[model samples]
Target: MIELRDAAYDYGGGGLALRGLDLSLAPGSFHFLTGPSGAGKTTLLKLLYGELRPTGGAALLFGSDTRAMDRDGVSDARRRIGVVHQDCRFLDHLPVHDNVALPLRVAGGDVASRADDVAQLLGWVGLGARMHARPPELSGGERQRAALARALVMDPDVLIADEPTGNVDWDMSQRLLTLLAELNRMGKAVIVATHDLALIRAAKAQVAARVLRLSGGALSAAGADL
Candidate 1:
């Protein structure tokens, strides 16, 4: 459902983040993007979700060229893809339940309409008790879970995460990976970008995950194993 053909990105004439990178993500596939710091992992994810257009080459998402899409079109396209960011930002004044339900709310779906479903989803992510708590009151792990819940609220066809496990402990990281694996089994394409090799290794044990390492302005596959 996603393809990048000979993609290259240049930020303000700086070093190229990706050069002549070719990648395709089929439905229900699971992938882990790994690299050292400043290896362009985040840049790749941004291109995938249409946050940044490629400077050279082509990127197709759901068969539409990202470069040709208008702002509203890009936003609509993103609705089909969910994203969990490393820094989960939320409205501090809103309760956790409201914050987690913001996606549906902003999309014109009634928040009150899906209240029970939101509660259930938050519970699944181990954030049931924090529903009434504000975002500022949540711990790092709790905030991460809330962000995951928000991302999945739309039942997106694809899920992309950047450094999802960066702020969590090892045990929490395992829990998050477990949840993502289950989502992949349910047919959502999953892609995670992380610098944590151990977490990538653990995810490999649970799913058929291909490790793609970005380095020196190019994207290439790592070894066959995790």
Candidate 2:
């Protein structure tokens, strides 16, 4: 549950990235946001996750204005949302499983009690055997899946993936899309921001997902063809 009401964000230096954005995401809903480079797709995701507060209008998460929240409030709000960045920034020195478990560790979770969960998630992402591999040892697809597993380690209510299929091949992109669709079926609200029209179209066939486009600092519904 995230809502933006006529939200406007100025990036300072006399530049406005978002202006008068009105978007709403309900529970269990899946959405795909596509746009050109510098179209503010990532900025929109940051707004939903409490990383960026709106400068002019309302940016609400589960009914609360993000600008009104304190530091702890923002931190707690993030626990309900999982984010997968395009870069898949994993610790180079840590094993894959440990990297996946880092979120829980940072949140002060009793990781020992949930070791099986980490393993299960890795298996779900088709990376069970590579648990002991380091980040440098993983392929691009493997790295993406590992990042997804790490994000889901928190069991977040909402999942925000930014250009998730960017670095993978077509087949691997389809696989990742299927995994995201499955999550939507399991009731995790999903928002995938990507530039790949093919990936978005493929995902639409697997799940009931809305495609939105960001252009000139605004959001609008787009056709499946993109």
- Per-residue lDDT of model 1, residues 56-92, tens digit only: 9988989999999998888888888889999987889
Clashes of each: 0, 0
Using TM-score as the measure, the top candidate is 1
Best by lDDT: 2
Clashes of 1: 0
Computed on alpha carbons, the lDDT of every model, listed in order, comes to 0.90, 0.91
The Cα RMSD in angstroms, rounded to one decimal, for candidate 2 relative to the true structure is: 1.3
What does the lDDT read for residue 109 in candidate 1? Answer: 92
Candidate 1 regions off by >4 Å? none
lDDT of 2 by residue, 113-157 (tens): 999999999999999999999999999999999999998999998
- All candidates: TM-score: 0.96, 0.96
